[model samples]
Structure formats: C-alpha cells, structure tokens
Target: MRLFSLTILLAAVTALAGCNFKSVPEPQVSARDAEWLAQVPKAEEDIRYARYLMDDETGETPGTIVVDTKQRFLYYVLPDRKMIRYGVTVGDEAYGWTGTSRVARKAEWPNWNPPAEMKARWPHVHPMQGGPANPLGARALYLYEGNKDTLYRIHGTNEPEKIGLAVSSGCIRMRNIDVIDLYNRVDLNAKVIVR
Candidate 1:
C-alpha cells in the first residue's frame, strides 16, 4: 500500500510539472524611445537587471501589476498564465507598504514635485522640470485607492544602479528603459498589488 501511494503521488507531481506554459514576449521599444534609451549609460554587469517572461505564480488575472518587495521584483501578469518579470527597487523597511491600488494616472518624463514628506526629509529638494536629469526618470504610474491618492508611485528612476534593492522612500522604482516599456504595457485603471 505504501508503494502504491508513493507511485500515485509521483504521477500527480509529474503531471503538474508537465503542464505547458507559453512565453510572452516583451513589448518593442519605439524609435524615439530607443534613441534616448541608447543615450542612457548601461548598468554595470554586477548591478544590471534582466527582464524575462516567466511562468505566472502570482495567481492574479492578466493585466495586474504585482510588486514583490522582498524579492525586489515586479511582475506584469500576461494572458495564458505567463508574466513579464522585471527587477525593481522597493521602499526600505522604514517606509515599506503593502496594499492594493489602481493606477489612476500616468505621465511621460514627468516633472518632480517632491512630496511634502520627502521635502521634510530632504529640505533641499525642489520641484524640477522633466527631462533625463529628473529623478523620476522616463515614466510615472500613480497608484490610487479609489478617489484617494496613496502617495505611492511605481516610477522610473534615474538611478538604475539601485535596481533590485530596497532603498526607496515608499515608491517602486525601475530602470528608465524598463519603466518606459512597462508604461506602454500597463493600462490606466489596472489593479496593482504590492506585497
């Protein structure tokens, strides 16, 4: 009876392991975006992050944006049980947050109006014009819970070297080029889960 039960368990495990999942390709970069992307300095190999199409394990529906703070990874769930995983920088323990929200707004090369909390922490920070020098980098996705702004963002960072680290104040940070790709892929009003 023990051997029979073991065989059944093994069969079940093998069957689940054999389940097929298709690859979802990353979105293409436009000519204009590519021009700027080329100008950005490449991250050192040690700090560089790789984007990949992976098997969906988050169990969320397609088009959901999931941020795993502990792993410092972000996943854009795709149809057919696939996801696009990108390395990211998350908030440190002092400011880490976990919640669900919807992307209420988006901007390209967005101007930086340092939040009051940030301003209090760094008094020298001032509103800056949008450009390559902007800390917000190439794109910004504002997360909100219904009509209330959560004051948290999933945005591009000029500091690409910080990818895969927990160093942000309370925002999710991605590489400039990667964020542009994500900006194009994500739809406004899409659900975002940060855990």
Candidate 2:
C-alpha cells in the first residue's frame, strides 16, 4: 500500500509537469503590438456599422473597396442591385480615387511598392516587404479589370488612426482588425468598384 501511494504521487507530478506549453497564435503580436492593439476597436454588434455590414455575398458585386476621403462605401452590386453599404474614410479629398476596377487577387501580409507615381508624390516609399511598419498591414486585395491592372488595391494599414482619414499614399487602407474582418469575406476575381 505504501509503495502504491508513492507511485501514484510520482505519476501525478510527472503528468502535470509535462503539460506546460502555452498556446501561441501564428504571427504573434509582441508587447509593442499589444499596446498598439489597445487603440483599434474590435468589431462589436452595437458598433457593427463601425466597420462593415456583411450581407449574403455574391459574385455579381464581388468584393469591397473603401474610399478614405469622400467617406463612401461600395459593395459589389450583384445581378439584383443588392449592395452592402458601410461607412468609410475616403482618401483625403486631396488624394482619393477617381477610377474603377475588380479584385484580381488577395494577399495576407502583402509587400508594398510605392508606384512611380507615388514615388514622385512621397519619395519615401521604396519597394519593401510588408511588415508591422509597412503601409500595407495584414492583407491586400489587388484590383484589375479584364486584362488591365488598375494599379489599385484594398489593403490593411499600420496606421490605425488613418482608417477614417485620406492620409494614405494612394491605396485604400483599412484598420488591421477591420481589414482582417474584411479579408475573410472576399475571394479572388471579385469585382471592386471604387468611385
């Protein structure tokens, strides 16, 4: 009986000691990130309109293209004229879009290259890998129409404060949390109408 009790205790301790690993998310955010995260609002049912209002998504109006200046929101208009509308921050009146296109591809944590047009405009954006600091934050939706690349994209931005401002170099930028939410709802080859 004495030996059995000792053996049970040893087994119990061994079992508890071996299960010490903590769960970690893939692309873990660090301490600094935690601080930054404190500022961005996670989507809530009350503030649901604060980010997006997803309806049954269809192929007709394939995806989302937010303008940060004019405060306009465009949902792909399906064969039925049903489109989801959400509030947005159009690129500042000085730097908003005046063209159109479709979503050709989608990328998570995409690289950024300041277009030649942008290079002359900002002169600070060099082609670079996407990261926490890169203008493109967690994802990117590349836009195209037919065989023509519209040179536009809806992407995540590190500047959470700019979600409602027209401060980007050119592309449509969303909050990291908001963009991730949007990414899950879109697919490749979706039409994106940016006015």
Q: For every model in order, what is the number of clashing pairs?
A: 0, 12
Candidate 1: residue pairs that collide? none
Q: The CA-based lDDT of model 1 is what? A: 0.84
Model 1 regions more than 4 Å off: 1-32, 38-41, 45-48
Candidate number with greatest lDDT: 1
Model 1 Cα lDDT, one tens digit per residue, 1-195: 999999988987676457543333555766755676666666763322557676898999999999999988899999998888888999999999999999999998889999999999999999998777778888899999998999899998877888888999989999886788789999999999999
Candidates in order, TM-scores: namely 0.82, 0.62
lDDT of 2: 0.58
Off by over 4 Å in 2: 1-49, 52-69, 72-87
Candidate 2 residue-wise lDDT, 1-195, digit = tens: 999999988987686457442221223455655555554444432222244334434344434443324654434332343444443445666666666566778887778877888889867769978667667777788878787877777876665554455665557776665566566667677656665
Overall lDDT per candidate, in order of appearance: 0.84, 0.58
**Residue 195, candidate 2: alpha-carbon lDDT:** 57
